[model samples]
Target: MDKQIIISIGREYGSGGHEIGRKIAKLLDIPFYDRNLLDEIADAKNVDAKKLEKYDEAPSRMFLSRTVRGFSNSPSVNIAEMQFDLLREKAAAGESFVIVGRCSEDLFKEVKGLFSVFILGDYETKLDRVMERRSLSAKEAALAIERHDRNRKAYHNHFCNGKWGDSRNYDMCINSSRLGVDGTVEYLKDYVDRFIKTL
Candidate 1:
């Protein structure tokens, strides 16, 4: 594989995609970008990290919020744009990184050495995972999953041409529920290894 490969992961809620990306980055000894991307962008744009986080991976529904927050004139300077700027800067610098869940898989489609992976899980497994991770009851976990999945889908559809969680948009789609977290990471590592050989 090229030394400056970028791996972008798109994942459904409770799919363990972040963990998988982190593990893959660790295995490859590369930097990992997730919520940290938001922090960086928030700092760069002089925006509140909390507000950016509130709208992260969510479709914009806050024109008044932005105006009230003194972000009216520069409406285009949204979190997504800031995140994209950061991602573009890093890619232009020939950085190798694994990025998780930011509509990045679609955004970097034209970039060389960029691989997009989508992770999804069966509903039952996803609910279980969310419950465990968030210490929520089953019903609460299911609701959270549904809400997040809807937001993610809406965010991707609004921001990118492709539909979120659709296999056709990605280089590969894996069912983390079937392989489990560590196994999924191992599989992705091997897949990347093979992909590099082709390069």
Candidate 2:
């Protein structure tokens, strides 16, 4: 890619989006930011990283609209704004990177070469994948997936005021179950290459 490209990925609970984002970054020879973002935010704000993880993809009722409107600050909301600022700073500095989740689709909208993608899989596929990865039974996996997806949806809606996983919210929405992991990565690499060309 001749331009400074930043690929932002949003994903469902058990979708292979994280792996796909990592693979795309590897293929494109760029840095990958995911959980690492929490660490960076933690450092910048002088807060413990482990505490930030709970607030990572969660929309805290305490920190939502009313609190935001009143400026009744909470650590979680403060961290989120700080992280958004950090993302903006990184993009402004012309870094080529792939960021998974963290609502980058809306956060980096003004970025010149940013391409946002959403990844999802069928219910059964996601349940099976979560079961295998987390060593949980079918019922347990389904519950875990539900909890995660709900949290993510709430988080995205709170932050972006948009429907999570709606195709309209992203530059592309890929069904990871259809292509599997490696195939999804290949598809995204091609999609991103074409997107860069358009720039």
Candidate 3:
């Protein structure tokens, strides 16, 4: 706990990854970044937060340009660059925090205390959670899940060196369905403590 450490999480839709990350940050007494990262980016860059939200985790529409060089001058790419720049600035300042998504694993690969994890749940478990949380029908929830995951995968794979949600790319992969939210947070806290000790 004395040293600066970062926990970056990637997760499937309805996997409770955001809840787990928030709980972990509270337990560790560190900053937690998720959707609110857009606000930070907006404030830092003096841009409209609403504009950033449109391309938050969605991949760029300029497929050909992004495919050629991993990025383009589009708003999506510019926003991603700003986000990465903010993270790098914070990391350089020795900040300890938990960030969910945004392909943070690859972004902080060189940082000594970076711990990256991916969270997934069984299809039925995720589907049920999405239905309840979003107040959608089962079919609607399933479609949303599919669309969100697809977009996330495309975004991460486009910006990162490794495949999105691939276990090999992360320090650990957890099945959130097995432990649920609180239990998963507890487990991660223990795991993170042990990891920091080793560091």
**Candidate 3, clashing residue pairs?**
none
Instruction: Single out the weakest 10-residue window by summed lDDT for candidate 2.
Output: 63-72
Candidate 1 C-alpha lDDT tens digits along 76-99? 337776777788899898888999
Residue 189 CA displacement from its true place in model 1, Å: 0.2
* Backbone clashes, each candidate: 0, 0, 0
Q: Give candidate 2 misplaced runs (Cα > 4 Å).
A: 62-72
> Which clashing pairs does model 1 show?
none
- Predicted candidate 2: what Cα RMSD to the true structure? 2.0
- Tell me how candidate 3 scores on lDDT: 0.91
Report the lDDT tens digits of candidate 2 across residue range 1-199: 4699989999999998898999999999999998888888778778789988876777767534346454645655666776777888888888889999878989888787889999999989899899999999999999999899998888788779668888888889989999899999988899888889888
Tens-place lDDT digits, model 3, residues 116-146: 9999999999999999999999999999999
Per-model TM values vs. the true structure: 0.89, 0.92, 0.94
**Candidate 2, position 56, lDDT:** 74
Candidate 1 Cα errors over 4 Å, as ranges = 46-48, 62-77
Q: Per-residue error at 194 for model 2, in Å?
A: 1.7
**Alpha-carbon error at 25 in model 1, in Å?**
0.7
For residue 104, give model 1's deviation from the true position in Å: 1.3
Decide which is better by lDDT, 1 or 3: 3
